[model samples]
Target: MIPELCDQRIRQFINGSDFVLAMNEDNHVFSWGDNHCGQCGRKATPFRVYLKPEVISDLNDKNITHICCGFKHSLALTTDGQVYGWGSYYEQYQNAEGSDTRVINSCENHYKSFFEELSDNPIGSGGFGTVFKVRHRFDEHIYAVKRIHKEDEIKNHMEVKNLVKVRSKYVVQYYNSWTEGIILYIQMELCEYNLQNILEVKLQVFGRQLGEAMDSVEYLISCEIFRQVLESVQYLHELNPQIIHRDLKPENILITLGKAMDCVEYLISCEIFRQILESVQYLHEMNPQIIHRDLKPENILIAENIRNGRFVKLCDFGLATVHDKRVHYRTTQKHTADVGDMRYIAPEVSQGGKYGHKCDIYSLALIGGNIFEIDLFNLELEDTNVYSELYQILNEPVYRLQTILISMFRTRLWHRRPECSEVLSEYNEWSIDRNILANDTRFDGILSILQSNDNHLFIELSAIGSGGFGTVFKVKHRFEEHIYAIKRVEIKDESEEYLQRFYNEVKNLIKVRSEYCVQYYNSWTEGNILYIHMELCEHNLQNILEVKQQVFDRKLGKAMDCVEYLISCEIFRQILESVQYLHEMNPQIIHRDLKPEN
Candidate 1:
């Protein structure tokens, strides 16, 4: 960090032909540019770049009036009629020179001494970012360096901040950042191929055969590339800051050159997509979360040099943010960035709404459309005897993608969009079991289930019943049809008595294995909500007693009083047997709360 200088305001800033100068609100002149000739008005380490802007407090006693910039020179005019000049004063060569800039003799840098001299290894340049190729002298390892220019520093601070923290096979590896004046040098792995290259080649080669001859082999490369893209995107979205590749296009993706060829590369692949879906799941399950505002075919990179040309790398973080998920939707809406790729941007984002990580799902949907060569925006909407341009343009991509992408998309709404993790487990051909759900060992008993770390799988329904210890609500797995009774106990500031009671119940449940007792499934905790999901019964003994009191009022109590007595006896006998089963265990257990409500 450049110490975050936003609190101060610049009165006026002017870059001299050789050096730069700016006055702040404090009437202070801050200088830090080409200081090759001591024109910066400050002493600095030889051959060292002034990474941070420095204040020139020497002119504090003088009321500065005018500033001038000349070729390789600078001048300052003060209100006292005093003039000063410093910079290249070589008048003879000024007209015959090929350049005004010159490098002075300097001592070697201890850090860079191990590396070879700088070569004009410029890779590419564009409005957003530029790449340069650099190699170590000893190891001869090549690295792709990003040159972040001055004006664009604000736009790239987040990128540099994020890239350095990421560690993943799918994401471009970040090495280190070297600061020099207003520019930043980001070192990273170099990959020559990107998904855009593959996509373009596919379109060019399979252009005519796309509609008619679409086969497994025809989509193998596309499928593999897509899978890897998902994995990288997932990895980024899962970071602590929950990175979002705000600008995801093929160009941002970097690749290696393995140059390996195999027939498996031409086969329809699930492994590639599997890695992506799982990675997304991990990110969605995080606390604050992430949302990649921009995603398109261009952001996906193909590394033909690595893993037989089967790897993918995700890049670009200019617009990404480590969002506070707890922030109000209105607050998020007000603070949202207006930058994104229009074609792949979620409609809600384009329409300006506060959204969560699911925005990436919408972008992913657009990517899916592109991969399938489907023009999502052209799809026909259901007609009510009329047509709306906005209606078709927005709904088309969503509707065409729902069948393929699996997660439900409320094209017009933000909250209604399906979660990123849910899609991986519930839909995609590369879908896997929800690892959280699969970890049965973690849910030992009712209390263990109630103390679950977080709740994402369950959708709490209406209150069904209550006991002395907790309230039971009927809840359903958000993606499944099965319903369960979730016993919720407020854990915040919970007394030891309640804790012991809950743990005792857990012990009893764990010790007593039976078909008669309610089955325990899972439990998790979030904030003050301590919850456990278990088998939901139609009625407890209390409900039975109340219904029987009315003499066959409810559906189940239609039996005669005598028959009901037998049923009651059977229920009591089963409860007693459950207690006996606990007593017989090596560590005897007891249901102290054996009342009708219990």
Candidate 2:
């Protein structure tokens, strides 16, 4: 077998009268076998036979969608409607006036011949150029075409270089780029809305407040969007001579709806098959990390039109930097100091100090705080005071989402900030831990039993008791109509000894099935909180003592009498028997604080 043929993944194969043609998944055309009458689409030789497959270089210029063969010729149809033919028939008109010239001319400006601007007005514009929505004439698929003026060639070329080098689904897809006279054109995958637009719309819906707390659904969506953004940035960082998007803000991120192309192309009339999406992966592994000096909300884009699921795409690599790890650190002396947005720029960058990839993490910290509606600290303030304020905010109770941000908010202490991978790993751990309470099937029984008549589950009717370990709440199971005392405990940050003691209490409840002991129902843990469901008693010993004293005063008008003494003696006897039951066990269990409250 031909080594090249073996390496290429052939998507389609065909046979001509004296030759064979194959189109690979990448849309590159290859030919083997007989080369008679130029049917092989290669240099015509005297022998007219080729055992090894050779790729047709001309067809590679276009995205050949389909290929077919005639008796002594082969034809290729490009995505742009242009048809290419080779072999004896084309040789007949090789010397015809303008026929050969026309073919050469068509290949010269393939971009112009295939794509046309959909509208006169550009969809987006920046310092380098205006971006227009264009449609491929043959495929009729829409794309974004950025037209950059020659005056901004440096920035435009840098962006093109980075976009072409990085191949990631989270990053905006790059197609083709070319120079025409004084303008440079770049074709890219089209996306609908940027994060800036999404946040503005959300702000309007939430009473136009900047720090308005996002509801549960909105919070989850924000987490997903932010996670994708992190993934894209991580991709840049992972690249050797890492790419740093010095400009990462909400305006640069785009969003669009998922495509239904799979359904449109399906031939079978089955619902299950129609839901599948075209499989493609754009992952590339490399050494080092990229620094996006200007990392903020405006640089992120979201695509809703994806077949699998909607995701955010990173764009505008104009301010990105390919930082080589050999250099160790980068100083702002060679670059413009005021290039990034003032609000999102890291302290080191703004202060003209040496900086590195952690700058992006600092920006991420601020963006994360904004996403969770946490108050944004004053960036211009002294690092000491700012960190102090943050410390105070963290001292109190906070959402797990906000806690992750703390590790990224080292501010002036850039080294303390965690890398993108570390931060993402921690965030994923927290997310999975919390999800167990709701999604794990093992907790379904406890969850179902905790439901109450109110809209919320696990509603506490009353606090029946309290101790060092946890609190006991009087609750009623909605479906079972059974009242149960549920003990809620905070196990987070507790010592191993404390945890072991708590588990011992639970074990004792389970093992001792005596009538004197409280009945244990169920137990479960959610995140840091531990819960135990037990039988709810109507009254404790203290309540009984007070009630008996009141009855005696009303009836006999005196203190304790002979009959009252006998009643007290019986209560004492039961307490002794309960203690005796514990002592009888091989490994005795002790009630350390045996009082009326117990």
Candidate 3:
């Protein structure tokens, strides 16, 4: 029988066998069944039977909408929007004095009295117990109230202990829990919709039925969501407790809908990407490795306020466990199987071997694949090997989405994927390259020069600067009346080897066309002297710095501003950009002597 309850229009159903289930108006599960082991407090009977139904005393006056049930545990939500749970699952595992084999009745007296004093407003539920939304009796501050069953008090206590030790932006915050009579209550940060709800929304917005009118803004928003999720997971994995959200799924993730609805469209800008990358980098640097066994879109949450949207948090750590380096490697050799979601499980995890953090990497890739519409799951393998297919996907240039997805899906447990640091590095490199390519015009101009063979502007000029590799000269083009700086080198230095080197540098510089980078103009050679003409600037960055030391006062401030402005300018940006580009290029070039001066 289905029973409707709560102001939010929550409904409950007692299945044929006697299990009671509650659901919110949105149709999300709120609570289900009896906690004999404190698995269901309100429905306790001397003997545990599937058909018996009992109403929770605390829930009878309120409307509860959704519930989540974990192994031997249950959570409940009221229509008045208050959340509560009376189950022994968490307590039994957590309480130090609790015995593992104790029967259901030993905790009934303790359970009956725990439901008395709680201000209502239902939020959600989890495996261990129910979480309620509550406003402080005095301050009206919102909080998540978790009700743990007496039977499961030991487990609940242990979870709380672990929660206290974990500190990370990605993991949900745990406040405090106390017992009044029979019910145990835990208060935490109040969250909105779970990841499942958000995904449903995204699915609707992107589905074929949505047609061509699918907004780019929405696509961008989704990308931001994906980025935030990764960052949160990365953070959790880097914690001191090294927490992993083993049950990461859509239902576990909670989004602040009110925040999302109020956020402006442009809030997910480049700055947001920067913050995301920075956070990822921070997590990778943390000590003691953390690996998330479960990583899917559902485990990642999005906070309200788009610019502030980076509050993507990872939730649901019921199955999380800590592992050291030795333990981690040993587990892979032992062929342990507890790892991830089926669709996102890495091949190694599926093979039932020792898997490490790469499992998380694989799942992250799946999330990306889903969001970007990349067919990573069905991609044609380069060979019979899945790893080869993954590599090929990473190398593919046309579909950036596929490349990122494949990179995250490395098939081998060891060589199959990059560590969090590597993943973060690659992302930064990509972002930097993208930004440089988008704003710089130097490459376009150089291409124009290469395309034209006109020799009308070539002319001899006086020397400007000299170095071991080449000499620069102030030159004026005869036809265009343009003043340019030219670098002259011996013919031997202009040979194919040197020419290739020069071209590489030019290519690197072109890629970074920032205002601070020395601009390339044109190139040619006269007999033994090879010449390269470039844009003429009065001072280089080093020259300006020297000027700053000698000329203090208002000029110093101006000089500093000039230096900062130039560094931020397209030219200087290109300089640093070129350095990074060359560093990652084929064979990996190193700028051996980087300093204030060349």
Clash number for model 1? Answer: 14
Error of 2 at 494 (Å): 81
**TM-scores for every candidate against the unseen true structure:** 0.26, 0.33, 0.25
Q: Write the per-residue lDDT of candidate 2 for residues 369-488, one digit (tens) a residue.
A: 554444333112223332212123322223343455665664347777765555444443333233324543545554554553232344568998888889989987765677788998
Summing lDDT over every window of 10 consecutive residues in candidate 1, give the lowest-scoring window. Answer: 259-268
By TM-score, highest first, what's the ranking? 2, 1, 3
Each prediction's total of clashing residue pairs, residues at least 3 apart in sequence or on different chains, is 14, 33, 69
* Model 3: per-residue Cα lDDT over 1-598, one tens digit each: 3343445465544331224555544343433344354555444444454433334434332334556565555555543344554445454555664223322222333223323223354566667777765556544455566777778766766666555555345667765544555676666666756767655555443332545543333455567778888988887777755777687787776664221110111112223433433443443344655555666667766666556446665665543344466766655444357456665556666656665555666666666555434445344335333221212332323244345556666443355566556655555333323433333365556446656543335565677667666777787776578888877777465568867765665565556455535777556655665566678865665776666555544454454457555544865666777687757666666766565555
For each candidate, the alpha-carbon lDDT, in order, equals 0.57, 0.64, 0.53
Q: Which stretches of candidate 2 lie over 4 Å from their true place?
A: 15-20, 32-61, 69-74, 86-92, 96-118, 126-129, 135-143, 147-189, 196-221, 231-252, 257-598
Those runs of model 1 whose alpha carbons end farther than 4 Å from true positions after fitting are 1-121, 204-212, 259-598
Better of 1 and 2 by lDDT: 2
Q: Which structure among the candidates has the greatest TM-score?
A: 2
